[model samples]
Target: MTHTTRTNRGLLRGALTLAGLGLTLTGCTGTGDPAHPITLVVRDAALREIGADCAGATPYNYVHAGTELRFLTAEGTLADSHTLSPGVAVAADDRDYGEATRVPSLCRFTVDGSALTAGTTYTLSFGDRKSQDFTYQPGETAEADPVIALPPLGDPTTEDTD
Candidate 1:
C-alpha cells in the first residue's frame, strides 16, 4: 500500500478503537434503577372538570401511601385503548386535553384495583426502580368561560304566522 494510504488506515483504526472503548465504559457506569412505577389517583372534584384548562390543573394526583409496589416493565394499554411504550411518559399531550401542552399531569397509568382505598394516600412504582408519592384530595371546580356564551334566539311564541 502507498505510505499515505497506510497512515490513513492506521488513524482510522485507532479512532474506531477509542470509540468502542468509550461506549464500553459508559455502559458499565450505572445510572441507578431504570424503572420505577408510580400511581396517581384522580380526585372526584378534579374529575368533574377534567376538560377545563386552569393553572395547576392536574388530570390526576399522585397518591403518597408510603408503600412500594412492583414495577411492570411491559408496555400497557392507555385510555385511548391503545398500547404504549414500556417506559414512555404518558403526558397530557398524549390525550384529548383540548390544548397543546407538555404537562405530565396526564400519564398512562394502570389502576391497581387491589390497592385502591377511600381517603388514603398512594404511590406509583415505575419499572421496579423509581417511585413518587403524592397526596390526593378533591380539586376545586373550574368556572365556565363567559366569552363562549351562546347567542340568544327569538322566543318561540313570537314565531311568524305563514
Candidate 2:
C-alpha cells in the first residue's frame, strides 16, 4: 500500500482501540442499586413550645427515585413516618410566618430497607454525643442543618460511659 494509505489505516485502528477502552470503563462504572433510602431528621425547640397545631413542625423528608416518604413530629414525639408516591411534597402547616428560621443542627442518614423490609432499625446515638438544639418558625422551608462532627470511632474519650 502507499505511505498515505498505510498511515490512514493505522490511525483508524488506534481510534477503534480507544473507543473500545472507553466503553469498557463506562460499563464498569454503571449505576448500582441504592444501598439505602435517604433519611432526613430535624429537631426544633419551637415545636415543643407550641401546641398540637404545630406538632408537625419538626419534619423529615425522605426521597428516592419513585418513592417519597415523610416523617413529621407527632404529639410529644420526634418523628411520625409516612410513605408516599413519587413527585409529591408532604408538609405540615398550621400558621404562616413572614420569613424562614434556622434550626441549630439537622442530621441526614441513609437507612437500609423499605417500610415492608424486615430487620431494619433507625439510630442517631453516638458515643459521648450531645444533642444539639435549635429554633424554628412558622412557614419556613425545611432544610438540612450542619452535623456536629465527632472524633474517630476508636477514641476512648469519646466512648459511651453506660
Give the per-residue lDDT of model 1 (tens digit) for 52-150.
232212422222122233322224221111111221122222236566433333211222222333233434343333344332332221111001000
lDDT of 1 at 86: 21
Alpha-carbon deviation at 79 in model 1, angstroms: 23
Across 65-106, the per-residue lDDT of candidate 2 in tens digits comes to 323233222232333233322211111122344354422222
Pairs of residues clashing in candidate 2 = none
lDDT top scorer: 1
RMSD of each: 26.5, 25.4
TM-score of 2: 0.20
